[model samples]
Target: MATAPEDGMKHPRTTNERLIDATLDAWQFGGGATISVRSLCASTNIQVSSLYHHFGSLEQLLVSAQEHAIDAAEAWCTRQIGLLADDAMPPAALGALLAGLIDDWCHDERRLAFAWRECHLNAVKQATFIPLAGRWTKLWSGFWAELCERLGIAGHAITTARFFAGESGFHLVPWNRQIDRAALGETCTGWSAWLCGQVSPPSPWRDRARALAGAGLVLPPLRDDVAERIAATAGAIVERSGVAGLTYRAVAVDAGLTLGVVSHKFRTGADLLAAAFDALYRRAATRTADELADLPAMQPEAVSHELAEMVVGEFAGSLGLDELLLACARNPALRPFGGHLRYLRGRTSGHYLAALLGPAKPTHHIDAAIFSSFLIGVTGVYCFVQDREERIAGAEAEIARVIAALTGG
Candidate 1:
């Protein structure tokens, strides 16, 4: 029931203007994966012909909408940064400024909605959205960098900025879940303090000495069998609470092992996460291979439907893959494993493409790549949407459409 902004009482909006507005509104609320020509027409009260006339394809429209959203976010951030510069307070004021900025962002529905959409799309559609995503990153990073510089904080300004922005976004999620506003503000303030080096860094040697003292206490060796059990436990933690929840302590409790045991085996949380993802990727690859082997031979036209069925089956079998991938996307330490996972998915797409298109060509390779990327985006949609059946149906329909378009069927 969203509507386009009115120019004035004197002038009615044009069909193209309405279409653009509706597209942005839909994307802001439901995300890019959910926006369609039909939905745009329905929201804008325009005909299909007009929609096509303004935007030739859904991809083109999505690009336009995303671009518009990015521009708006940039403008807003710029304005906020300008205000911060003019205010010009002491170093201690940084926390208040950040808390205020978060408050402003939380109150602005349009901006909040756009941010949520961008975050979701950035998680799953990185390849297709690289340009826009890069711009958005640069915008926030630049703002944070300037803020840090003004506050006399040194060392890796852009990196610190990006980290602060990411943490702020995380805080926003809990706030939206109806958590107390003061608690969220306090959390953001603490993060801001840490980023500005106001908080003392942990003493590594002290921890190491403590660990050495504990070493005298008899503990079981981290054997291969215990390591595998720890990895399995980490995977289950990821499945239930995502990568952020896969701490060493959590894994120890879940695996029914001592913290020292999990720590001795894994060394770091990233190590534990890497093991979990490796086990998960291997299982998914094996399952997908088995599914493909079982698929009956079919003509090229029917191949698309079969592929759709396979996609749905994969999601049905792996419920937490989407959430884990989102976590991987956000964490830099997990990128290498994430790349491997993507490669496995691409191989599955290539296998399907080979069956449908016969001999592979450069065009077939490109088609397969696009198909793989689209499936990843579909998984992102699956992460947020409530009704699994409806999301699966939509994903199937989208896969069929992509296949038909690729094959000229």
Candidate 2:
């Protein structure tokens, strides 16, 4: 169980501190995404009166816990950046630094990252969380901007910030096999240096990473179209309230079908969720196809602008896509379907890159994945943060610049 940090010698924890610590512990390890007063009290051995007295309510306590988490993350990042600046590391070191940061977040401190994202999803679903989410988006964006400036890569700061955010989400998916951490680190280092205007040597593992690509998002055909309708209904619920909201009764009621029939078709909540994942991916795949068809005729600048718009629009307009992808990762039965999204995310971006970089220039799957992930990060930040329109415009400009850099245009 997590507890409040000790300054020197350990002092006895106050009731408020104990409550907050319990919440953080549950968030990090105990699968406590949705905590209640009862659960917190039960775990901490504190009475309900104490919780109400210190935090007023469970909602306030959760908020306080999130605030503490974000603050800790910020402090850690600041320390890392300070060390980098003090060492006067060259631009080439940026990638290694980035790799190190992400490595820590994904490995040693993975539970914190997981909890952070879970909280973010909740923030998106509930209006009450908007303030915290927006503040977090801003603080992190500023941190990225500062790091870029310090590293002499100020020009690509916004785009890099957005890309890192997306990469954070992309790496969150629990893959069947262990991730190639060294290859991933080297690839990121080379790319980071290249982006910062260095002539980076091609990573040996580039092809191997690219080989992880999937055959794009292809769903198995349903025996009857009604199953598709049922999936769509379940997907809509996921969009509104996440996977927890997806139930047979809810889907049946929403789709105007009988519970017996819905249950008969899907059999289990996991089955329905799997079907919904297919449905959501199908929708995204259709959009990717439709968007790619026009890229051939569009100018490179127009293609860059459109790519940014499309990615942001897709994520901002619907919450189900991210939720379903995460759900697929968590559920064993849905892992196979989830794996495709891991590699194929860049299909649309790859096409857009092809239009910009031309048929001759190699637009690798890995590049597409990076670009698409950045777009995802951009969308994630833009959706919750303040100055929405301004940020979008700035992000589009940075996206174009990144496209130019990555494609050697």
Candidate 3:
């Protein structure tokens, strides 16, 4: 059993018993974002008003959920760290600890996927989770710092903790296929061991993770060959259906996973789509290394050409683009969408400004915004042109025209 600090915290098993039990069952067993209220209601078969007595709204209920998770996580960490006592951090024990958390408690490839997605898309949920996240970060960092000290790695705890967190996720996802729980454990163990051998993961958490796994509290974390599955799922959605088709239920069913599993990772369909987009963008960004490197000295025409390609190749397949645009058009309130516009500007406006201005510095951001707008306009057109050559030629022509106007070229 895990230990909690002497903070008179509610046991997630009792106290606010219904909320805690519901949360634990959901988070650990593949629960959905709306599951907090829905599950509680279903389990108790209570009236909405009665439930509101305890939680004011769905958002409040989620806060309750986050609070429960925070307590559980703190207790979990406390127990693992206590086991280390005065002993030097143990590598194998650390692996088990991480594997257990990732594969079991955090639902590793399960709940974490949900946690990551919600943190991005759900503002209400995001705010609700902040405190829990702080607890998590602090505990993990402390454990890592202790580990680093034992293994002779010198660094500020914050830096080392962030480094470990970044690396820890490398093999956890199923980029190729959706890593399974068992494989996740192995990967966690392998990663912890590897990190321990090299510079070492910030210490107590690492060994404690492994220790927890060994003690049957968590499953071993390892890598799975699921990259292909993840890729295929993403490719199918992009090539055939685009963003609208990337729903949680659809993805879960297609991937032969529980809907809860998908929801746990991604609270809403939008989150799932955004993540898929980001992953694809990152992959394409890697291929644009030379283009990025040469941006500083490239001719205006070359820069324009690169921006055109990104608009067509990277964004053309977003099925939701039209719907998104239409929503903004129909819903007057959405017209002043600062965030959306800012994001578009980041991607395209700077590129356009830079291409039109010259090879000098500071043109990119301005041009990227302009180009991003042009890209949005093209999205609005809903061009169904099937001829690749014609499309390519037209894009080039449009780029030339835009450049001429933008730069007096």
Candidate 4:
């Protein structure tokens, strides 16, 4: 007979619990989309049979991992809310609460990992995980709605919650890079306080704009080369600091150009973002084509592996593609540009299929769409892993799996 662990559950229950815990831990670290059952088993010291017996399928296991993480986050938030003893939380209490949330989000590795995974899953629109994702959104929104009501903060509660959720991922970026945590926390607290209407101040950027306008500093028109440099600078900003950080002033500072020059060239923030994404996509396409050209002619039986290698190489070398895609996915101003990039990628995939298969079937077009989506999901997952070699190996394996499925290999 199988022996039970010290926790007192029966052997099977213990095994299932271990598998669930291991799956959550691995999924949080490896990202929910890229983690395979084999990896999970290796990490957990459990067998594939045990995983199947518990979760039935990889998709179910991922769903379970998401459910487990969401439940844990909700429980933590509920406990934090319990700290507010009265019906109405005062400004001080709200500030403290927001600060505590920021601390948890920044200092806790598990929370940070899961938050990034949730953002990626949401961006990719993975249908299997939508219900769980919706639950998380509802939980946070409900908490914010109640807090806003108590604090008499008159605004769209759900929108405010969603905005904070988006900002949470943004917050994690600096945390991941071991940037100044103290400064990040302070900024988060200040932003939260301002959002709750607890603080009101004149816009610093507006004041700067006025200062610039009052100076009567007429700038020359942007030359073509300077305009391209500005666009490339914007791409780097989006890659490094995310879409929220891509301000005209920031671009101007980075490009060594005056703010007037950047503004004159791009006109609006949307125009600037479009230009940035255009540069990013063109660079990615060019890099991918270059790498694919280096690969030998594909054999039908080995084409999947060749394509997988090409994808891994492209992603490994491309500096901004991952961040650019995620930032564009979340920014409404960038959606049309993102859509155009997706169409281009799908067309590119179809071209590769035609090259390899001699003729593209109707199914090839659909496969190309699926292939594009798979690349997005895998790339998102790849960004969160801490180990570079492990990330590259996982990318190759995952891409191979995707290609095999698409090509019926």
Candidate 5:
């Protein structure tokens, strides 16, 4: 790992330190994705009153945790940059420095999973997501500008740099507890170095997919017509419902197509979502293959974290059928319907990680009992907010504790 950046100095641990640290994990794992308050309480090991005293209402706490985590992350990255003397900042040094900084976040499962769920309040006009992520985007962009200038290729730097970061990003909301960060980091480092060398300026997206051509994509390979309609439906749901309003009926109506078509093409809504989501996810996953394919025997650990972010983002965006998918299970009259939506979400998620590690068989299913409880709990906390930002911080700290207990993490 490279030397720590001066800005990386952690803030003085607070009275709410546990929640503060967990806030980073929640945002990374959940990303403005909703969960429950009971779940949050269980996760944090704090009573509702105690939480309220320190962070105010649930909503305010979410906002606070988010500010804390992002501020810390920003400081960490700045510290990494500060470590290098002006003359000593070589291209390789820059890469190594960034890698080390990223490693600090990526290798630590707790830190890597926060922003994904906490900031979800920013979704749609309804919104979710860390209010502070704009800072992350801006900071990362700045770093990209610097990196690209050092490499003498600022033209495509933003996309290139985002893609580079994407390689290690997870993008999922309320992250899968399945990933092993240490293993994932190894993959990113080895791949990051190889990718930097291969592409003149380095592109970490489809370019990498073209070379190795592993599984290419992960869906069942639908007919063009069916695929188009499916995509149209799925995209519409995301645009319309934030993440929970998607339904088979909604898909049929939006496509101006019949239920028969949806049913015939998709054995069940879950099946349809699984296939479409997987296809989309695979395209994204192709990044590892594209960006790091040339690396002799890629490592999964390095990019696993980034893939997790991508997965979270894709999942957050997909709103197939409420009954089909289960970001974390809950009871609905149409439970299968929710699973269908989530299947699509989860399958797509797998694609991002597939390039580094062959897509693992689905092992991320959550309990309907706890899942439902968590959603209600988190959403309830979020809904009561006077300040959306405040709600988000509370949500992160609260959910982190739940996840910690659930995963025994």
Candidate 6:
């Protein structure tokens, strides 16, 4: 019988709670999807029997960790919203607070940012997590909507909030050394101005991003037939379960090939990851080329409709590019692929501007990056909302705002 601690002292977590905490720690900081029951038990110094007795199964423990992570995320967001809701907070102070909030999520060791992202991915993979993820989306979107209304940016409140959400997602890419505190602070300050209806807010980071974009990484394309099949299968696993779920055996089974076949081609797990990432990059590149050629000639409404559909796919987790790129953050061997993708996504995103802002507008990689963030944000809003018309309308609204903000229309 353990007693609760006295005031100011930390209460000792129960055995069940400790196991759950360890699962979350692994998810947040380790290869969560691949973590074995034996590893978990060893880390917790708890017997394997205790784990089964406490949670019944490892899958159950993972679900419990997801729930715990969501609860903690909501609590933190509520506290931040409370602070931001102060009517008397000055613009400078508000900007600082907003920047601080972004920094708190992205720059620190809290790993809440990563946890939140994993939750989004898990929501896509696990049907059961949808309702919980939907609840979170509703709560946060509503909070941002209310804040936007209060700040007088109510017209595109939900989409605007989604942009911030997307921006945070961008920062979570571990290889993005460009997203420092100063950059986030300035970005938040610009956002503060935009919230107040000031178009063309100070964006010093744009020039820096553009300059950095010129520094590109080289990734060789995958050309072998057998290797391509293995890589594609592994990439599917990555999208479905995440990089943690990618194993040679899993890929071999899924690809209808033997383990030795996969091992002979890729040599190691890292080799498999590299090939898969290369395939994803090449696939994205081909799609980008097609979009550039087609999107510019299409009617704005048609383009909007097409993009809205993509957002729908994004919500379903069909787009595994994000998972692939973010995995590089943890794997040094795969950093080149991730770095190349940063440039590729920026270039790919330009098609949106070419379609909407016109090819003559002279957009840069930074503009495309900005557009990507807003679009990613819009995808989140579109995910939980079921009405197709409403989703399209939301997409259009965000597009219009992006055009106006970028063009200063």
Each model's backbone clash number = 0, 2, 57, 0, 115, 1
Supply candidate 2's per-residue lDDT for 46: 97
Global CA lDDT computed for model 6: 0.65
Candidate 3 residue-wise lDDT at 203: 35
Candidate 4 worst ten-residue window by lDDT: 174-183
Model 3, span 54-84: residue lDDT tens: 7778667666665555565556656655665
lDDT of 6 at 170: 55
lDDT of 2 at 334: 54
- Lowest-sum lDDT 10-residue window in model 2: 209-218
- The whole-model lDDT of each prediction reads 0.55, 0.68, 0.44, 0.54, 0.43, 0.65
lDDT of 5 at 327: 32
Which candidate leads the pack in lDDT?
2
Top TM-score prediction, candidate number:
2
Error of 3 at 298 (Å): 14
Q: Rank the candidates by lDDT, best first.
A: 2, 6, 1, 4, 3, 5
Residue ranges of candidate 4 with Cα displaced over 4 Å: 1-13, 91-96, 109-116, 119-125, 154-156, 174-179, 189-409
Superposed Cα deviation of residue 108, candidate 6 (Å): 3.4
Could you tell which candidate, 2 or 4, scores higher by lDDT?
2
Q: Compose the digit string of candidate 1's lDDT tens values, residues 275-311.
A: 7765555444443667665544666546655565456
lDDT of 6 by residue, 1-409 (tens): 5555667587767878888778766756664564678988998899999999988988788778767777777777777677665564444354566567666776663566666666666665566667766766776687676666665556545655676787676555545565445555665565555445442255566445434543644343555888889877877787766787888989999999999998998876667877766665555444556556888888876776676665553343335666865576556666556545444465656676667766555555545655676677777556656677787777776776655654556
**Preferred candidate (TM-score higher): 2 or 4:** 2
Q: For residues 187-235, what per-residue lDDT tens digits would candidate 4 score against the true structure?
A: 3344444344322222343233223323422223345999989988887
Q: TM-score for all predictions? A: 0.46, 0.82, 0.41, 0.46, 0.44, 0.78
Better of 2 and 3 by TM-score: 2
Cα-based lDDT at residue 75, candidate 3: 65
Per-residue alpha-carbon lDDT of model 2 for 287-341, expressed as tens digits? Answer: 5566678778888777766666565544532467877666554555555555666
